[model samples]
Target: MPQWDIAVPTRPGRLPGTTMAGFSDRANTFVDVEVIPHPGVTVVFDLGDLPLVIDDGNGQERRGPVVAGLAPNRVRGQGQPGSFACLQVRMSPVVAHAVLGAASEVSGAVLDLDDLWGRDALRTQERLRAATSWEDRFTVAEAALARRHDAGRAVDPEVAFSWARMVDSRGQLRIDRLAAEVGWSRKRLWSRFRSQIGVTPKRAAQLIRFDHAAHLLAAGHTPAAVAADSGYADQSHLHRDVTTFTGSTPAQVARAPFLAVDDVAWPARR
Candidate 1:
């Protein structure tokens, strides 16, 4: 197994609701990484000798710059034997709608960046590949995100508020109460949230809850304890959720390489 050289911003950038990390594998390594489901959206800028390979178990593999939408499941990254470097950005569904522009309704799928950004995506990749340092790459990436965010449409305030509440509650918040708090009827909230955020509120909450429980498991917490703490009905409920989102058991999730790198990549949040 090859460990990633992860670099995060020394100081927080101006972009709100977004985080950036740069990952490079300098050794001649072939890595097959199982990617777990996450609550937010992910964008990867491939800056390596070869394009990033993503397999979703559908007998098809996608390469190059791609966006992993919220709750993308059963996906894996298979890197060829050689050095590889990339800049990765994770955005809240709220911010992702704006930053991702045409791909705003992305959920449960991985789409090529060029399909959405067209020539702009290729230009941004070139800029990232040309950067002399990780810091420069981060700068270029953030600037590109900022531009898209500014020009793209934003989600409704109610949708953003509901998302924040779910995140704050670690996905334990009730959907009914969220709608009330947002001053929208349940039907309206559901329709808007699904359209703008890419997933329904209930599903989003489940994903967020799964994310929290996954991290706790990665932190060495026992499944039973994590289940009780994360609002799962019981260990069985937790088991089902974990299996649904990650296609892995609690034990397997606890040792996931993707989660293991989070503390180093997003230390403050961890």
Candidate 2:
């Protein structure tokens, strides 16, 4: 199997954050566990017909469409890690709107995989088998997305940068401050943000906070300090967010050996 390297691509358009791509070589063990420690959303590309099973704490197993925008704390189960080679496109909520069309508002922690993939998802996977390079794979995926009924509008660079700053701040900053910095009113900011990014400012803030905390926890930080430093009211607040978004405690996550990937780390409080 090929070693996986997480690559953060330059922000595109108004998209401010980076895109992380993880690809495994043919001989490696299959990847079974995928713990999403970020609050934004994902657009996945399956490069092979290998079955991709997702169990988000739900009893039934699902396999289908590429997921669009899933809120924080969503857990997905992939059957045996080595079974497939995949590409995951990670983006902040603002960047998500560029591909998902409208700013999304659904609040469920786990989205149904069937709702996103449909039958066409299988066809896409089949076509990906012929792809030779990452760029080719992305091209195939983009072409498939273009055929979707609701692929959403592409985001501009300015909006993406604003969203990045907000997410990177972890909800510590106020919307008015953000608006002022961007030269827009609170109302105008909210309106444009909702239309383009989906979710309200408050919800987006929550996701950002969760993501910031996750970054810290993954890096080997203690939960107590992570909470205090990440601006949570206390350790309990951090625990609640972790439980709500990741379905696990800080201790549980910290002890998990498979999650030791490089991008997965606990961020030290600044």
Candidate 3:
């Protein structure tokens, strides 16, 4: 993990509720990379000359450059091409549907960007690779995202409100409460939310809660303490979630390379 240095791009004003990040692997040997389901949708672009292989737990292997939208419990693996460099854009699901223009298509699966963006995917990659600096690349990428987001239709406001509640409460908010607050019946809310956000409201809450607990564990908190602080029922509940979402125990996730670099790459979490 130490050798996999992450570079955080300066905030570009093009896209709202989006974070652009870059990772460079100094190690010139092949390594395994696994990404658990986070609260947002991920769009990964390869800047290197080698191909990036991705397995979306779909019993088939898909290669990058790819756009991956994962629901809760959808695990993905990446085979690094010895030395690799890539840029990843994480958009809150509410924004992702609009930005990617394929929320329903991308939900619960990983697909090549070409399928969604067509020729634009390769064209964007060329622009990204031609950029002189990471900053320039970030600008180019964000501009593209902004264009799509502006052109596409957005999710329902109720869906956005429910999602905000999930994040603001760290997934501790109840679905019934969210539905009441948004003036939607429980069934209606559930239907719209799952359709718009890809994952259901309850599942989204679990993912957000798991994200919080994972960070706490990585910060050296005991499972018991993390469970209590993260609003889980107990340590066993936390363990089940960690295993279900990540296929790893608390101790293992604590040392995970992907979660390890998050603080530096996404420092706004605090």
Candidate 4:
């Protein structure tokens, strides 16, 4: 993988469910990067001379600050011919629901930040661009998220508890059992979780499981071993999930740049 300047938060954010990374491609060379699916909401603030371009692999593209909802499939960054700097934020869907307002708007979609925050998006870019360093930029971004989260409507506690359980078990627990534990009927839990988290509970579980398996693959584990460890029925099941989520085989995904930089950019996960 090609090296880019990556910056992490100097300290944990005030918010519990958010992680920050700063990235800059200062080479002024042509660049293209594939973006794999992940189980959270992604917000990117552009502070470059030219805007960052995101291609959805279907002839559609968006530039400038953008938000991608859970499990956005087959997306990539096509860097313009210039240096680019941006602060990228990953939010747990529980927090995303409050921070981004209507989380369903971003679920499985890529949208302009302006659509969500309007004038505030531009103001945020200016603030981040004026910051002296990556650490400062992370501070600005976190403050903005904290403000929105404080004012926005929150998801039900039952739904939040369900998501927490899924993450705790690496998505191996049964959803029906989760509902029982959360003190909600399976029907109510499913409805509330889908409306707030953007994806159905089962889909969220699959995404979390797929993320774990992908990282294991990137760590040099074989497909058979990754499948067994990640709770798939078998190697073939893992292969299908990998192909479905990333449009790539397990072998190819193991070498993906998207997964390759997770450790450098988000060390806390390691």
lDDT of 2 at 18: 25
> lDDT of all the models against the reference?
0.86, 0.59, 0.81, 0.87
Model 4 lDDT tens row, 59-127: 789988889899886888877778777789999999999988787788988888889888888898889
- Lowest-sum lDDT 10-residue window in model 4: 261-270
lDDT of 1 by residue, 128-160 (tens): 888999999999999999999998898888988
CA shift of 140, model 1, Å? 0.5
Clashes of each: 0, 30, 0, 0
Better of 3 and 4 by lDDT: 4
lDDT of 3 by residue, 1-270 (tens): 326767777664557778888877787556467786677888888876666677777677776667777563345555455657788888888888987775767777788888877888888989998998888888889888888898888999999989998899999999999999999999999999888888788888998999899999988999999999999998899999999888888889988777878878777651
* TM-score of every candidate: 0.96, 0.71, 0.94, 0.96
Give the candidate order by descending lDDT. 4, 1, 3, 2
lDDT of 2 by residue, 1-270 (tens): 234444332223123332545355455555566555555566566554465666555455556445546463345646454546666655555545544445454233344433554666667766767767666665666565545524555655555656767766877778878888888878877877766676667667766787677767767899988898888999998888778766788887675444555353212221
lDDT of 2: 0.59
